[model samples]
Target: MSEIKKSVFDAMPQDLSDEFFELIAGNDEVKIERIISRGHTSPETGWYDQAQHEWVIVLQGEGEITFADGRIIKLGVGEHINIPAHCKHKVSWTKPDEETVWLAVFYS
Candidate 1:
């Protein structure tokens, strides 16, 4: 059989006006995606209250996540965080000078 190889860092766009999301793989119970951000943040009045649990890691650059309860978590390269299902949170900040690559796994 032939081999299929891919890199999470590939296909980066030059214009980052919007955050980029790419689905790496998925199944019925779990989904994996790669997100690239540059100084991106959720809307001021919006929060992510996901139905599935999410575990995210910062592979490059830095970012901050803010919870509805006023908690802010900072993550840099090689750092990670687990967001429980239905947890309310939003992205507060990200490194503007460089790309903040995130690998996220969402599972039920």
Candidate 2:
């Protein structure tokens, strides 16, 4: 058997003026996505209320997340968290000098 080789750090756009998202895989019940951020944050007046549960990991660099109720979560490399469906959250900050890479799994 042959192994399929891929790299999570590949294809990063040189111009990181905005965050980048790549959909790696998806099925009826689950979706895998990769997000690259360099000093990115959610809109000032908005929060993400997702319909599906999301499990996210910081693969590189660091980031901070804020919940609607004022709770804050800090994540560095290899750190992860599970967000329940309909939980309101927003990304507060990401490392500015380097890319903060994240792997997010969404499931119903």
Candidate 3:
């Protein structure tokens, strides 16, 4: 069989006015996605409380995540964080001058 190869940095969007999310791969119990953010943040009154656990890593640039418990986590290039299911969180900040590339994996 032939091999399938793809680069995470390929096809990056130029319009950074809004964050970009693309599904890289997935199955019934897991999903892998590529997210690109540039000065993007969750709504002031919104938080992500997902049913599945999530592990995210910053591939480029940087970002900050704020938890409902008033804790903030900063992720730089090559940095990662694991968020348990039902944990409320929101992205507070991202590099405004450049794109912050993130690789996220969600699983049960």
Question: Which candidate leads in lDDT?
Answer: 3
Off by over 4 Å in 2: 1-4
Q: Supply the TM-score for candidate 3.
A: 0.96
Q: Rank the candidates by TM-score, best first.
A: 3, 1, 2
Q: Please say which candidate is ahead in TM-score: 2 or 3.
A: 3
Please give the CA lDDT of all the candidate structures: 0.95, 0.95, 0.96
Ranking by lDDT: 3, 2, 1
Instruction: Assess every candidate by TM-score.
Output: 0.95, 0.95, 0.96
Tens-place lDDT digits, model 3, residues 1-108: 546898899999988788999998899999999999999999999799999999999999999999999999999999999999999999999999999999999999
For candidate 2, give the lDDT of residue 50. Answer: 94
Estimate, for each residue in 1-108, the C-alpha lDDT of model 1 and write its tens digit: 546898888889888999999898989999999999999988989899999999999999999999999999999999999999999999999999999999999999
Shift in Å, residue 62, candidate 1: 0.2
TM-score of candidate 1 versus the correct structure, residues matched by position: 0.95
lDDT of 2 by residue, 1-108 (tens): 556788899888898898999998889899999999999999999899999999999999999999999999999999999999999999999999999999999999
Worst 10 residues of 2 by lDDT: 1-10
